[model samples]
Target: MDFLRHVKNILHTYWIGFVCLIYQVLWRPKELKDLQQHNGCVAIVTGGDGDIGMETVRALCRHGMHVIIGVKEETNGQSVEAAIKATCPFAKLDCLPLDLASFASIQKFVQQFKAKGLPLHVLVNNAGIMHAPFAPTASSSGSLESHLGINYLGHFVLTRLLLDMLKRSGTKERCARIVNVSSAVHAISTIDSIKEIQFSKFYCPYGAYGQSKLAVTLGTYELDRRLRDAEFPITVNCLHPGLADTNLFRHLSPVLQPVKNLCAWLGFMWTPSQGARTPVFLSLSEEVEHTSGKYFDNCQAVPSSPSSYDVRLQKELWNWSCEITQLPCDIQDEINIHYT
Candidate 1:
């Protein structure tokens, strides 16, 4: 049975790769222009030192928005900030240390940002690990699987912490945005029980990564629903950044790494800048300014996996996330009262 599951997983991965190649051949990557500039608006992008995240930060900086990059290392954050400022001399940028694997670090990063008294206009949860070796985050409640912890839970806590600020910063005319960088592989993931989310005794690298991304997608939709129900002017959405040839593949075996690079060089994968396009578009495009709770690819709304839309699954994940994170079970109620 385990062998069958592994075979299925491999097939799914190859199928997605084949589909991405077709997408690259059939469509030209779109460019966004004349983005409306918000000189004082602040945006936070996690993993800003990475290929796609850095490009997203660069695009935002070019448009006059203040960008705060959340990095695991202070030096990496500073390096990215300096690189951007070199090109855009007036770019407003700050780097804060953020390690998503650690809840205390996430909370500290939020507190530090709050100290700056800046309003968050956009948040790009762009940090993720793919097919990494098995490891678990040492959490207060218990250990969390690394992929789920960093990719979904950490961002989950950070967003909840900043929800009030995003609410206050947004108005009817301009809603604050939350862009989660999910993946096409999420469609193949399943979360039928809490065990699937918290910890699985049997671990498969791609399986773990896919389940985490699926959680991200599920959380995106659930949070958007709650915000909209409360009439809050905040948009929550997630997207697939295409198969970009970024260091995300650094986990691959050394023998397979060159083959991956060769495929990328041969036009089978997107460059980091190309992967940044849809995220940048979602962040700044007037087209989706009010769009919420949708999944996107290549700058267009596309239906996500059928399971992703299951209200039961969405709420289950939301409730479980709150329980594990030690947040109030009825968080939306808290937000509503805080706004009132």
Candidate 2:
């Protein structure tokens, strides 16, 4: 049975990759434009120092938003801020140190942001590791596989910590936005049980990466449902930025690197600017002002993996995430009390 599951996963990964390649080759995704300026609005983008994340920050800054970049290293954050300011002298930006692998670091980052007394209009969970070597976070909450720890759980904790600020910043006319950068690879992942979600016995790098992305998608849907039910003025959405030619592929094996390079040469992969379109769209477009609980690609709402839509699975993951992250099991109650 395990062998069969592995075969299925491999097939799914290749099939999705093929389809994305064809789509990018056949049609160019449109750039986001003509959106009204976001003056006075504040946004946070995790991993804003990365290739795609840097482009995302640039786009938001170009729209006149005050963007706070969350970086693992303070120097990287400062560098990114300086680089953007060099071009757009009017760009309002700040750098905050954030290490998603550590719960303590995530908490500290939030406290520092709160100290500024700024309202968060958009939160982009953009940082992730793909096909990384097996390394677990030394978090006090509990050791988690690096992909799951930094990719999914860290963003989960960050979002929960800042929920109140998001609520206060949003209004009926325009809702606050949460943009989670998920991937089509999530379709290949399975999380039927808690044990599978936490730690797989035998880890395949691709499988681990896919599982973390699946977790992000599942949590996006579940949180959207909860926030909507509670009448919170925030919109939660996830997207698959088309497979871009980014540093994300640095971990690929030598055997796969040649194939990846060939794809980039053939124009099968997206540029960082192309990859940033959907995320930027979700963050600023009036078209999605009230859109929630949907997965997007190429700036359009599309269905995610069949498993991602499993309501029971979504709730289970949400509950377990709350337990592991030490958040209130009933987050709605916390939000409600804040509003009252």
Candidate 3:
């Protein structure tokens, strides 16, 4: 029975991979073009040094947007800067240090960004950790799991801190964008974990990762609602970049490494550039300019897991996040709408 279960799991994984490949072949994103609208626009991409993140930055730069690449270390940022300059000789790029695991670091990053008086037209919350050993972040609030703290809460706080800049851009362009990079694994999230997070012997790293990603979607929805209520033209959306061969799986146990390698050899994995298509589409695609609070896959709007749409869960997570981060829960009251 144990062997049979393992066989079933392997088959299911391959089946999903096969479907994603077919979908990509049939409905790939249109070739992105440079747009006059992106000239002098400022954007930030967290985890911009990673495979998919770097590709997203490259696409954004090719479109003429001035991009800030947020990396955890100065050296990584330097490397990214060098890479971008090699391809885009005239690209406007800045590499900044951002450590998402530490809230203090997040605050400092935001403050540094604001000190420059830069206008933020796009924010791509693309940095994340996956399936690592369970532990609290160095400065995580109240024993919050590291993955949740880094993957969701850190970006949550970063967005709030940069809200004014984003809102300001909306007034000028009639549209500013926030793109949260979630995952198809979000479908496995359980509301109970999000509402009352507790890790026990049954706790699985992948499960915690899913719950954190689900929070990302819920946060996107709640933020969209707040912006719309205030008549701000800022659009917030989330997406699942297809499974790709990347360093994200460095935490996989030794026993599973062979299986992962086999899958990669089978042509089932997406290249980083292919995985980036959906995020680039959501970030700058004109067709989606008026859209907000939507979940996307393969560069198209799609229904998220039903639980992701639950108002109760969304509110619960939002409030919980505010409480943990010590951000005021009444942010709606603080919004000063500049656009009618």
Candidate 4:
């Protein structure tokens, strides 16, 4: 049995490497040449303090966009600010407090952002927790699984609060973009009903993570559809950043952690920079300026799970998200009224 397990691990590692190699060979993203043109444009990146989120922030700053780094702690924000400045001295950056685990925090962050009177041109929903143990969000009052609350519900509220800003910032020259950093693991999720997602119910760490990621993708599709119907020049898309050795995997059991590390060392994983490629491309590349509601991998548009494209599921998820997040009735009506 032990030998069979070892062989299975070897096969898994090689398969990962094989897929990565194919993507690397086929999809090479080119850096936007006239990046300075984005100067003065504003971008807000959630969870931009470290990992792929930090790398995404770096790429945006280097292109001369004014970046707002959303972090839970001000000190972590300051550290990220200092780090970005060290390399891109011309980078215009601001670190603001944002906790994805709490709806109150998201509302407060939006208020503060609006007070700045800055137009929001890009939003990268890059903050997410993976394989978290059975727990509720910091508030816990809602009994929402931590991963679902933080990864999907938080971003849902954040985006709704800022929809006005994104709409106002759109133009033929620069259509506002929202890039959701999802994962390939979304394929594992088969969430059929809303009741199946409560934190008080049966929980599997990895399964919950997959469900949340799948929600991210569905949210992007619904947002895209609504924006198009409203004639709003905003694009929303999601992508699976190649497997990278980031801190999001810390929840792995001690027994499996070493195996994960071994896989990374054996060339099956990407560095944070490599993982940042698809997101940065989605955020900056002019090629996809009009692209919305699409799933991408390795910086290219690709088919996601068939379930992700189900229009009924998309609407169901959106409405449920609004209800769970406790969005105001009038606000929810206002947003939904635009849909056909």
Q: Which runs in model 2 stand beyond 4 Å of their true positions?
A: 1-8, 140-142, 334-340
Shift in Å, residue 161, candidate 1? 0.1
In angstroms, the error of model 2 at 326 is 1.0
Ranked by TM-score, the better of candidates 2 and 3 is: 2
Tens-digit lDDT track for model 4 on 3-66?
5533443454446445755564465543345434578889999999979999999999988789
Q: What TM-score does structure 3 among the candidates reach?
A: 0.89
lDDT per residue (tens digit) for residues 1-340 in model 1: 6667666776797688778878887886777777788788899999999999999999999988999999998989888988888988999999999989888888888889999999999999999898898888765444788989999999998899888889899999999999999999998787777666754456777777888999999999999989988888899999999888898989887987887888888887889999999999999888998999999999999999988988999999999998778787564646221110
Instruction: Report how far off residue 122 is in candidate 1 (Å).
Output: 0.7
With candidate 3 superimposed using the best TM-score fit, by how many Å does residue 6's alpha carbon deviate from the native?
Answer: 14
Give per-residue CA lDDT, model 2, range 1-340, as digits (tens). Answer: 6666666766788798899999888878877777889999999999999999999999999998999999999899888988888988999999999999987888888989999999999999999999888898866434688999999999998999899899999998999999999999999887777668754566667777889999999999999999988899999999999989999999887988999999988888998989999999999999999999999999999999999999989999999898777779766556221110
1-340 per-residue lDDT for model 3 (tens digits)? 5355334434544465567666655665446554334788889999999999999999899888999988998998888888988998888888878888887788778878888888999999999998888888776544878888888999998898788788888763459999999987776665754544545445567667777888898888988888888787789999989878788989987997897787667656677888888889888888887899999987789998888988877888888888777777665556322210
The candidate maximizing lDDT is 2
Each model's backbone clash number = 0, 0, 0, 0
Local distance difference test, per candidate? 0.87, 0.89, 0.81, 0.81
| Runs with alpha carbons beyond 4 Å of true place in candidate 3 | 1-37, 193-195, 333-340
Q: How does residue 44 of candidate 3 score in lDDT? A: 96
User: What value does the lDDT take at residue 63 in candidate 3?
Assistant: 85
What is the alpha-carbon lDDT of model 3 when measured against the actual structure?
0.81
